[model samples]
Target: MSSPPAVPVTLAEIARLAGVGRAAVSNWRRRHSTFPPRIGGTDVSPHFSLADVEEWLRSNKKLGKATSREWLWPRFEALGDRNETGLAIAVVGRLLAAGEGDDGGPDDVGSGAVRAAVELGQREGPSDILTFLLRRWLDTYVRQITTTPEPLADLMADLALWVRESIEGEPREDVVTVLDPACGVGHLLAAAATAVPAALNRPAALLGCDRDPVLTALSDVRLALLPRPGTLPPMPVIASGDSLRADPLIGTQADMVLCNPPSNERDWGYEDLATDARWVHGMPPRTEPELAWVQHCLARLRPGGSAVLLLPPTVAARKAGRRIRGSLLRTGALRAVVALPPGAAAPHSVSLHLWVLRRSVAGETPSGPEELLLVDAAARFPRSETRENGPEWSELGAFIRSVVGASGGRAAGGARNGATAEDADTTAWATVVPVIDLLDDEVDLTPGRHIMSAPGHAGPRLTDSWNEVRELLDGLQTERARLAALDLTSGAADQPNATVGELLRAGALSLRSGRHPTEAVAPEPQHARIPLLTLSDLLLDGSPSGWTNPDDAVVAEPGDVVVVGIAREFSAWVHEGPPMAVGPQVHVLRADPQVLDHWFLAGSLKAPANARHAGTHASSSSRIDVRRLQVRRLSLPEQQHYSEVFRHLAAFERLVERLGIVARKLGQDLGDELAAGRLAHGK
Candidate 1:
């Protein structure tokens, strides 16, 4: 093989091979307890064999395989294996980091209010920023451990415990290996490794993979750092390369594979690799790479090996994709499908789905057209307010745990027998609806269909919610009517003014955009400091939010307002007193103090009329900021009104913010009660 890697690899060497930043290598060690041992028992500069660590990464390279099998079919896709060492180079060179923009901030439009938040966080006690960062980072570590959807950290940790329970219940005789193909930075791998001892009293066979060199390397560092019981392997297997195109660890069969593949890709690089091997079921449509990933994962596993994947609804019932669907059902590889909440995947707006696949038996056994085990998990999750960091993921994990533990409830419609003697004999509580109802046109996989969407509270029913919604709508309509009666067109509030649309067409005010910065972490300049507002720094409601850990390097000026054209989408909001500079992509509109009021500019940018001019948003790691934004115009008088409106809107938004905070408290408390069974009927 590769010449018995010298001694053990050094973390620095590993970091280089993995393509990560040096700091990231250290962070990986600090985060993962089971990282390779230090050469001299020194945590700092600890070293391990490159070959040994590479194997460890390969062992966990299950994720890469799943990703490969899904898109390329039979053919193996090779993603550039990477970690953080050379990440800076790749991000700068290949990714074209500037071509794409970030998704815009939170959807809510509380601009002035958000500005206040960023200012407050910046001005607040140092502890707030430090505490935020530490907690967030720790949560990220916990999330990596579970390798699950973006579940809340605590909930994901618990769900990981449940995964162990499910696997343990299956009666494993030896060490168990779990693979996550799209292991973004090794969340599931870390969890699988950690859970092995707790759930099955054995060491974990946690492994993972990804197409991005950055992610794979990051995964390596994360897996390397975990503390292991002396008996366990020192590192987790994490490799870089397209999991679908080529196998990182050829001739390896894993017991369990888990993943959340990218929803859809335009050029998954499939056109170049036709006539490949992985596609035993059928060729996947370019539009439906997810299907290929599903089949590829099935091909990778040994018989009786199980896998879980997050999917979109189309995989279940789309007519264009019926061939693979029919094949999977007839082959009986499909185990179960769980419907998740609509907004389950935050970064991606698509409705999320979960699918479980098991390899079919060789002989024509009792298993025939098996009905997939379907769990409508949409309504089971705790409300968003209660989700600690991310509630959607928290509830999803808990529900997954419950379903996995549930006994054989239903069989696919084509099964030879109604229920196998072994299955019928199980005592675990579960229900199995026939597959016929879930088939064909009836097969929409939204969780709302299968999962019971019952509210935990005993007091109110659906009718109450309906009434409240109506009441709220009625109140809003009344308020609108009242405002319409104000005769604003003739009043001082309403003047002969041009909309922001007109100003842009005429070019009275100036809209300038700064160049995109080459480096994300650059040395602080000793010039007049300006608040650099990336889309990320601003929350959806137009609040200037900071990372849990604050980066004091970027500051703001007095009238600096940020309009983000990142992955999140576009909207402009003024920063509070602290002056901030706009990121390179975000267009900075400089107005003479007399010409354009800062608040008015922010209001005009947010005005619904100007949204169309913002241009179509694209789907990429970075967002798109169109040049059109830099050419907008607005009259001085109209700008003044826009500014005034922002002032009033800001106050109302703050009130809503308080109400939300209170609501979140109630939701969290309610979740605790419900999950603990305190909210059960008659309790």
Candidate 2:
């Protein structure tokens, strides 16, 4: 009756099984490598038995199994071509990974690997840029751009993703449509689509319109290109054109409006729309880029619709622009102004704010006086980054979704990702300051400035990371002090340049590397833990390398000389911090106080002629390469030169420290106020 499963699958099925493109399968035979060999497909298509390959791949993944098309494919060719087909991606993963070891890089399942797997899809086809874009899109799909909206664009996207996802929390009527008038490439629309999956029973009927034809065209295509085929239809007609000037989607009343319009597009057709109906709250001043988008988004939405847009910080407190901004806030339609990080955008890195707006008739609204929900994610995510990443998006999204309370449903909803209020103890750090707090400070809505660094994380526990950061900070502080003391003791010019051997003889340099097996240091995709340094650590004085950097491990302490190219500036004081790691680029130099004071050496690098001469030999760029340091004119008494130049270096170091402290204090004060929620009190 039933019988065994059919034997050889089609070439297409083979390709699918391998997770490789059809051509990749063809290449396997051409390469004549050890891939499983089953035969069957259009034009003598070859295949392998499923049982044979799956076992082999599992074994390979466990070991350092690097494979090549040459190494693994022929195995398939040897076996009788054959079978297995289903709607699952797992079937193909095994065959695809079967011959993947020879590349040498890890076959680890990750974004990089994902990119590599997709790279094969174009083995026998496609252009580079398209491939580039494809890989980037795949990366983007795996990630949520960010939840923390710092720049005007960031805030806008955040509000958009938030509202789109919020629909499922409350089972609203499936008919409500959401629109983003000034959409740039449909980022918001796509995010909305994902957040409100059709399975939720209430799909977000996502729509958007942008003035830029190019951006709009791309959005149309992107909406169509779902990761998996045949799931949902491409998004409905997303209009292209200036929404303010032309009514492209005329007579359409959207249930929700999300827009992050251009902040400063000089010519906005302002003169033509003086009597625009959307300007119910306030008209746009020549300077305010947010005003036009604000009115346009509002006009597009029906009564009770919600519109969230990001505005410049200047709008909140700028005296001249205050009338419009103030009036809107007073109107209560301005639900929130969440401040963001300064470097959140390109061209300019300035703090921005998000303004959440609700559409309601003058008299009919919720119970409380107009209130605002301010979130300062600026401090919650990666501090050094201009824009937040995936984890940040997930975290920030949770805040907005939970805070809004999913009114079409209930308040206190669950966190977006795996996070909970208890995950990092974040709820304790969450500050719900009032609009008046912002107004009191004249609305200086800088998230970093307002949100204070709390004692601990919110919900999840991060004890290990917290402790590590504390240790790092302590090290920096200790190093700073040692450098300061040396500045006063050795002055700047006490150090003179010298080679690693000289520093070693004088107890300033030491060489450390694996002695027995140099081969043990074979390059991993990521470099060794040893840090690479540059001369940027020292200014004026010839800088040493391998002193301090994130990746650097301090194997050699302060006094140990990192021998690089040459020895010079031996007399310069240890102006740089202590116990720093040296890069191969720079040899760490440990100095003997009895032989030469570091202060005196600090000034010796200033001799322009010597500086240039040393740099030429050392291969230093804008910053010096300590490894390049070589023994130049050692004829001069090094200590004498070091002593001469010490004072100037010390003065510079002290001044920098003072300036840093002041800047930090100002930032900390603002963060403190925002975190306490004192700034977020009633409007």
Candidate 3:
């Protein structure tokens, strides 16, 4: 019997293949009778046969130059099950790694997928192809997969390596082993392996274990394919099992451990492993599985070995884990707690903590009172409008390293003097707290509590606050004057109007909808080259907060008018900065300056009447039908005049918003300082 047809693709995929917006695809389906019919998927997101669609596109000369890697993803996705998709990817990895010919395999993955993988592998090589497929797969199931962000992973790896070097002195020439007990997709393990500096002359052996066999297989493939130095050790040892319960790497201690363990897991073998020897600190309470992972990491470390764990902030202050927290402090296992800004990882709303721990060496005792370094970087979180990736990881990482290094120097009673002037400046954020003080009733290790209470910590200045408020008031007054200068007069009774569709047909404007980045590819504040203006940015009237790849970006020029395609608060504005990628569900309209002014078009698109007539739903939030939106036809001079007025109005609104923010901050600062007796009214 003939093999079943290849996996169908969604409309979004077809649009991607055609190198056009989704709206363009929708238009083609509606206007062209020969458009392929939906073969599968729901009406909301219909899927079409890849063969039929490709044939149609080729016949119409609409197909874009797409790579084999791009074509292979849909077929792999067509496998219908996520498990099968993962298996198919893993099989491809194995085939490429083994350099085997594509014969039909026992796995349910179709022959077409295997063939496509072979073609992609030949063109891009094994490593590139596997990495691409893995990224796509992760993006496809982003909500389900929880991999560590790249910057955070690098920081964790660097911190672990630094701690190891500090405690053990010089790096050993032998193969240094690294372990990740909860290695999801091997990001942490891969990071650790690559983090070993070549100057150390030490090759790394990576060990990873996870509960999911599929993830374990993928991690194995990922680690196996990583470009290693010439001195690299054998393929990484990746195991499939619950690391906490089964202890797959039992009795196997590594020189360094890095893990982003699963948080808030009550069913993490708590009852069965009550008497587990790994619980050296204390039996982790049922509500505190993170504490269990912490102990497990410590247990698996060789003498003086270090582990860096990305944990939830709650673990530092939770009542249930106080005993374990105190014990860790007393034993000098937990060395530092660094508070990362929100959006550093999964569950983007809450700030996360990095717990740096080092297993004590045999016969080692505290030379003096033990100290726990606390770095509070939460206040350094980038504002919503600032284009930054979390915080500058390098600066933050260096600050943490300095504090830890200094503490180590002090503990060793070296010739190095105490905190320097620069260190004093950082005291507002980083402070070394006494472990004895932390072993209180609550045993709270929250970084903010200690950092804020540290001597010489600088609070907000009253003079600076008042000056900011004064500046805001002056700006607001200037904007109000500019807005008031706009001359207003009644217009003629009748005015001619044209719909956006008519303007498009008349060659007065070109319209395109923004493409959403794949689920796996998120916009970053730094590193990425193209700035992405998202829907939230539009609604909040803020600058672009993230960036994406240039290849996948639909850049809007300075004069283009961008409108929110779907929202309760519909808005349209003329872009005025550098070219930026327009995010998903945003309509970018480029007006021919000779025929239509961009500012006029933007202001007209925001007209309340247009929203009513062009909206697809009557609810508060609605999808805008851009083609149906009407714009009043006006002379170029009149358009320019109106544009000037609209510009001034927009400026006025921004000033008003800034004024409110400044006023509120000033009020809050005054109230807080006065209440705390830190400020007094002067005569």
Candidate 4:
């Protein structure tokens, strides 16, 4: 019936359908005579007909007991193309929003995909279905699509709304309008839509524009499905086409704007739009596409309206954009420049910036001394095990609020005089530098530059430093004395050795690799509970910086040896506390106390010979083939003796490491205080 649905399924998808792994699917194709043949796709990733796979699965009783919603995704994903799939998803959203008995629904409601979507929508709510589908789609095309993370989107929305509230006072009856010119999948707009009504207690008219038609359609559907409080707001206006060239929403102005536009785009209509009117500051050079977006967002704002743009860090200090940066500062449009830590959003390795701007009302002069807030909140992020988890928003948000509040006070009145060195020290992370101070030849708007530590009074700080130094020196001497007592001697002894693979086969130890978190299932720092030990922690001998859900965790119990699977320097740690999750690129080796000593195994894994032999590459940076690593074959008594020596050596190494860290910190502090004339030599 219905021509077998003609949808293609990859081996991975087939494995998912059968509730098995890719290897199982491969085995089936090899061993089973009735297994489906490849209809299309490459040899590396062959595609099979979904109908054929389903028939074979049902005949063999291998089909997973999955709901209709689960089945809908693979079929939906197999649509004509990416754009078509996006459009189909959008159509499904529209159909879901239409509800039952709505004759106004799309005419193609009888289509299999549409029918399945309708059934799923009825079983679950329309909002949940759309959210589920969109999340999966985004996850599937993570590298291809550039959507803002929800937390970062929420932060941008909150920042814009808070700034608006601060400037305009109490909530007004007028409906606030918010615009995002490069809305992408409309995360920012959706965030703003939710935040504006809640904060302002009034309706919000949302506007969005993106170059992709499918994205525009999807955005419209997404905004429509959002649950609003009290009275319903007007339907959002999502326009298609490049906002820079075609100017879809040209004449529109909004109370607030939030955007995370594409960065470093070269052909963003520079030549054709040279004399365009949006360049209130100055014409942006071809290389400064982010600056163009900055001006565009500013232009879209109503007088005194606020905007927040997530931009690349280079936009703050690039030489080409210096003129525009200065103009924005001089005109008092640029309110603040906050530098977010790396992993805040896409391009996770580089620290991105949030440039907060406000449109100046006609004929408004500078109130008190004009100043711009510069906040470098990089250090404020919660201690994360990996860079991918991003910052803890609550702490970061509070820090920004405090900085902004302090800056507001400084703006009304001139900079405070007779401020103590302690007060100056506190402002090192956040400073409200005068606009005049920033209008130099470079006109660099980098937050780090303006927020550098200022010379402070050394009275109390110098006293504290002396106390710290004395304590560190005493501890260093104690560690050195302990090290001297060891009287260590090194010698090589030939012995029979067995590879880790042999040990595993002999049931001497159990080896398990850490599970890598998927984008959808990855634990956020806020939601995580169990401590997660990462490769960085293993290498540096530091405490756990990551966290994860206990159910998905690969926990290492006490006496288990955790080894870094990939590193320039091979290292291993003996777990000493409660069970903890091991993050990606880490291996947990649980040794049987009767067969092998945990300390001995850990120490053996860190040997230079093992590092070279197990490494896959000739260079220092290489992945370790843990199975290939050889361990000495020794009696249990001999192993215990070696373990004791290894344990003491490890403790001695840790002490030396601490001594080095403390000594360096004390040296830097003393050097800084003395050089700044805050401290004098004691007689």
Q: Which candidate would rank higher by TM-score, 1 or 3?
A: 3
Q: Over the stretch 65-177, how does candidate 2's per-residue lDDT look in tens digits?
A: 33332222222223221211110111123223333322333332232233333344235222222223332232222221222222233335445434444433333555557
Error of 3 at 41 (Å): 5.0
Worst 10 residues of 4 by lDDT: 412-421
State the C-alpha lDDT per candidate.
0.50, 0.47, 0.78, 0.77
Q: Using TM-score as the measure, name the better of candidate 2 and candidate 3.
A: 3
Please write out the lDDT profile of model 1 over residues 1-683, one tens digit for every residue: 12321344455445544555456667766776766556542554465643355555566451122221111110100111122222322222121212222223442222222222233334542224222322223232332322344242223333323333333234464777777777875666766676556645677677777876666754564455456774765357777777777767555577767777776675765785466577766787787788888877887787666666777777776665667776666676675665655445433223466776776545545445445566655444433432222334433554455454443432221122122324321112123545555566544544455543234432343345345545545555654554445544563533344544455455644555654332232112222223345555454333322212112223344575556655445566666655544555566555556667788767656654455545453443344333444323456686676566666665545545555654555465456446756544664
Q: Higher TM-score: candidate 3 or 4?
A: 3
Sorted on lDDT, highest at the top, how do the candidates line up?
3, 4, 1, 2
Best by TM-score: 3
Candidate 3 least-lDDT 10 residues? 411-420
Model 2 residue runs over 4 Å out of place are 1-171, 198-200, 227-234, 342-348, 361-363, 366-368, 379-683
lDDT of 3 by residue, 1-683 (tens): 55567468877788778878777899999999999999887897788888889899999999888766777778887886667788778877878877775767544336678777866787689889888888777766666777897778877877776576656454464888899998988889877777764424577899999998888888888788888867759789999889889978997888899999999888999889999999998999999999999999999998888899999999999999999999999988998898887667776546789999998886778532378888877754434422344556656555555555555553221112122334533556677888888989999999888764223232545577678778877877887888776655678747989999999999999998998754323333322256777877666645665566544567787889988878486778888887788787888999999999888899889888898889988676678899989888899999998888888777777778877876776687566555556654689
Which scores greater on TM-score, model 1 or model 4? 4
Cα-lDDT of candidate 2: 0.47
Question: What TM-score against the true fold does each predicted structure earn?
Answer: 0.50, 0.50, 0.77, 0.75
**Number of backbone collisions per candidate:** 109, 117, 1, 2
Look at candidate 4 and tell me the lDDT of residue 537.
61
For model 4, what is the alpha-carbon lDDT of residue 367?
Answer: 45
lDDT, candidate 4, at 329:
89
